[model samples]
Target: MIRTLLVGGAGRMGQALGEGLSALSSVDVVGLVDPHEPARLFSAPHFRSLEDVSVAVDAVVDFSRPDSVVLSADWCASHGAGLVVGTTGLSDEQRSRLERAGESVGVILAANFSLGAVLSERFAAMAAPFFDRVEIVELHHDGKVDAPSGTSLVTARAIREARERAGRVTAPEPTERFTLESARGADAGGGVRIHSVRLPGLVAHQEILFGGPGEGLTIRHDSFDRQSFVQGVALALAHVNDQPGFFSGIDHLIG
Candidate 1:
């Protein structure tokens, strides 16, 4: 069994992971690292910080804030634990830390831990070179703190890379004048425009639109519940230790 420590034990995603993992015989919730210490979903020990935990675990699943990223890699290395990180909106410095940490221990960092989302990104990239212009719209619950969603960023990056491989430049842009400033969504490099929508009823949804003369294509993915993320998380936890480097997407793990 994998002795696992949940870094954001009390958060929504963390709780979901705990509930799902508890049902499986492959993983045991050895410890929880969260400051709030929300209602217990399991009988695991709770620590306000990973630094405070005395128990040793084989792996850590981090779904916490970007700030918590400061110690994640080092914590994993010091504790001899493999790490599966799903935190987004990371700064350049934090990314660098992950790269360094991967050299010492196994690490898998991904924007979204949903299999459907990863497949959607892959399909979008495959279709990118054929389209003249593309736009992405991402919607999430109002409680989400990040804009454009990390999945959208990952999709944009994949599209850009595909275009580069196809010997294509950035997608075409509209020449019309904007009546309102910032009317167009923010350009996320490679001429990909991203629109972020946050409202109460959304539980993670993204649409990618590809346009060419007289034809268009739309690819979309929706995560209706938190459980949509469980399988991917579990898969990452199971395979992380086998690879001793930082992988940026779920594609590499499942593939």
Candidate 2:
């Protein structure tokens, strides 16, 4: 069994992880690390920080803040524990830290852990080379800290990379001026436009629209609840120790 620890144990995603992992026989939740202690009782113990953890942790599942993700990576690197990070909105330097830590221990960092979302990314990349015009619209709960959710960014990157490999040129933009400022949305490199939406009642949703000769294709994925992520996290934990390196998405782990 993988002895796992949940960082941000008091947050919604952390609590979900705690509950979900408890049901899996392959994983043993050894402890929790959260500065804000959760009122809900858990089977495992809770601590303010990783420094307070007493058990031998084989892996760590972090659904915490960006800064905390770096700390978790450092601790996992030092303690020889594999890490599965679900936190988003990480800066370039923070991502670099995780990459460096991955050199010493296994690290799986992903923006969205929903299997459907990963599949959507895959589908978008597969369809990218067939079309010249593509745009992305990502919607999330208003409470989400980042615009153009990480999943959208990853999707855009995948689309760009796939088109590059196929030697397809980026779609041309005809608009030289806009009546309203920021009307065309942000360009996420390779001429892919991304529009971000935030509002109440939205969990997570994204759609990639592709336009071609006389036909248009749309790829969409929606995450209605936090539980959508549990399975992917569990899958990552099950295979993280298989190697010592950085995995940016769960796609590589999926069969």
Candidate 3:
């Protein structure tokens, strides 16, 4: 049985995870650590700090802020607990810190946990060989702080690597100088342009456009709800302890 401790248990993603974990007989909600105490009691004890918990948890799942992930990673390492992190917008330094922590215990980090999104990334990379021009557009809810979603960055990087391995160079830059800096979206790997959209009533979505000589291909993935991520999180929690290192995507768990 997997006994899990969830940090940021009061947040939206945390609540969804709590309910999902509670439904599994093989899993137990060992404890919850949330600074903003939940209004009602949970199936497990709620504590303000990891130090307050007396139980031995098999894993720690964090849906907290980026700033809190490093601390949680350290705590997990010290306690010999597996970690699954879903927080986004971490700086390069923070990511390095998490990687170091993973040396001691299993750690899995993902920006978007939707299974379809993971497949979309793989498909895009595979299609990169036939396409000469490519661009990525990622859309998310307005509340998301990051401009370009982490999923977009990952996809672009994968596509760039695949193209490089195929010995294909990106098309030359179109504009020597731009009247406005924002005229073109951010430049990602291999000069692939990335456009970000933030709007109300949107969950998470991304599209990869590939252009060849006579035809074009577009691959897209849309996450309509947070429930799309629950299964991925559950899978990570169930198997994280088996691997003792840093893992980046759900593709690794997808067989």
Candidate 4:
């Protein structure tokens, strides 16, 4: 029946997920674990901590902070349950903990779960090898805690991987010398540059530009609402149990 527990269920994303789950027929939201007050949209069991829950759930879907996410991973591992993580901005050590938990249970750790964002990442990777230079710009709401936004990082990584597969030792760099130290954006894995913008009006948006000799290709995705992420979360929840080890990104879920 896919008994799923929603972590961080009081947040915006969590509320959207609860609505999605309620509409689905195959999955049941068994409970919600969040330090905040009970989710106003959901009438399920509410828990301040996983330790307080006496019932056993088949899987956990996490949309919490980095610290709480690690603890949720541990809870899933100890209970032999599947875990789907949508939290971003985790430290390297925290990410490693989630990976290690997969030894005892299935884990799906994704930076961004919107289907458009997922597809944009794949498209950028596929076109990266043919381009001479690539850059990314990601915009998010100011309240977002992450700088680069998880979608940009994922897309940059995919772009870098594509170049590597093409036997390119390094990504093409900008020719202009930067007079200002902070003029250039942060370098993601594989030498891909990422520019992050956080403002009040923006929800989430990312643009990937691949430039060649005289042509350019641009892939873009916009997530105006948190509901866009729910379908991807549903997909991950349904398939996480089938995969035994740790998996990153929703690319595998689609392609």
Candidate 5:
């Protein structure tokens, strides 16, 4: 069994993960790190920081703030433990830190952990080379801090790479002038436009629209509840120790 330390153990996702992993016997929650008072969500000991943990940690699962992820990476690297990061809105430098940890132990960082979301990204990449125009629309709850989301950015990059490998140029940029600044959504590289929406009712959803002569295709994935991520997280944890390096997507684990 993997003796795991869960960061952000008091947050919604952390609590949910604690509850979910309790049902499985492969992972044991050895400790929790959260600033919130009395992090009673789990039976494990709670600490304000990773530096306070005294027990042996075989692996770490981080769903905490972007700043906290760096600490988790460093601890995992120093402790010789595998790491699975689910935190979003990380800066380039923060990502580099996480990648550095992989040099010593297994590390998997994924933008979205829903199985359907991974498949949707794959489908979008497969169809990218055939389309002349492509755009993305991602909707999330208002509590989310990121604008376009890390998922959309990764998806855009995947689409861009797929098209490039096929020797296809990006969609043509529109010449029409806009009356308002930032009218058209943020450009996600490779001429792929991403429109972000934050609403109270939405959970997590994305639509990839592709257009060609006389026809269009739309590939969409939705996560109506946070539980949708449990399966993918479980899959990642199971294989995190198999290969000792950073994996940017869960697609590497999925068949």
Candidate 6:
């Protein structure tokens, strides 16, 4: 059985993960680390800090804030624990720090843990070569602090890379000037535009649009609930111990 420790166990995603992991036969919750000690704890022991945990956990799953991710990674590596990271909005420098920490232990970091989201990125990359114009629209819950969802950025980057490899440049922009500042979305690599929407009812959704001569193709993925990520998280927790060093995205696990 995989002995697991969950960091940030008091948050929404963390609670969901704890509930999912509890139902799995191959896993056991060793400890929960959260700043605020929850009134009702899971089956595992609860600690306010990593230093307080007593058991030797096989892996650590993180669903905490981006600011805490690097420190958690470092603590995990130092304790000889595998890591599954789901925190988003990490700066390039923070990502580098995580990579460095991963040298001592296995690490899996992914922005969106839904399998459908991964497939959407793959489809967008596949469709990029055939079309000259592309744009992305991402919608998420209003409480999400990040402007554009990480899934959107990953999709746009993959599409851009594919288009570059196929020697296709995006079509020139039709308008040189805009009447309003928000008329056009933010610019992505290879001239792809990204639009972000924040709403109360949305969980997470993204659509990638590709325009050809006569028609247009759109690939979309919608995550109606946060529970969609639990399966992916479980998969990551199961496999993280087998791989050493830093890894990004769920594509590797899917393959």
Q: Ten residues in a row with the worst lDDT in model 1? A: 167-176
RMSD of 1: 1.4
lDDT of 3: 0.87
**TM-score winner:** 2
TM-score of each: 0.95, 0.96, 0.93, 0.93, 0.94, 0.95
Question: How well is each residue in 20-135 modelled by candidate 6, as lDDT tens digits?
Answer: 78788988988889998754467788999888889989999998988788878888878888999988899999898789878888999998899999988998889899987999
lDDT for residue 59 in candidate 2, whole number 0-100: 97
Give a tens-digit lDDT track for model 3, residues 101-212.
Answer: 8899999999878889989999999999888899999999888888788999999999999999999988887788989987789999696999999999998999999988
Name the runs in model 6 displaced over 4 angstroms.
none
Error of 6 at 44 (Å): 1.8
Question: By summed lDDT, which 10 consecutive residues of candidate 3 come out lowest?
Answer: 34-43
Candidate 5 weakest ten by summed lDDT = 35-44
| Steric overlap count per candidate | 0, 0, 0, 0, 0, 0
Estimate, for each residue in 36-136, the C-alpha lDDT of model 2 and write its tens digit. 98765368898999899898999999999999999999999999999999999999999999999999999999998999999999999999999979999
Candidate 2: residue 255 Cα off by (Å):
3.3
- TM-score: model 3 vs. ground truth: 0.93
The local distance difference test score of model 5 is 0.89
For residue 59, model 1's alpha carbon misses the true position, in angstroms, by 0.5
Per-residue error (Å), model 5, residue 45: 2.3
Which is the winner by lDDT between candidate 1 and candidate 6?
Answer: 1
lDDT of each: 0.88, 0.92, 0.87, 0.86, 0.89, 0.87
What's every prediction's RMSD, in angstroms? 1.4, 1.3, 1.7, 1.8, 1.5, 1.4
* C-alpha lDDT of candidate 4 relative to the true structure: 0.86
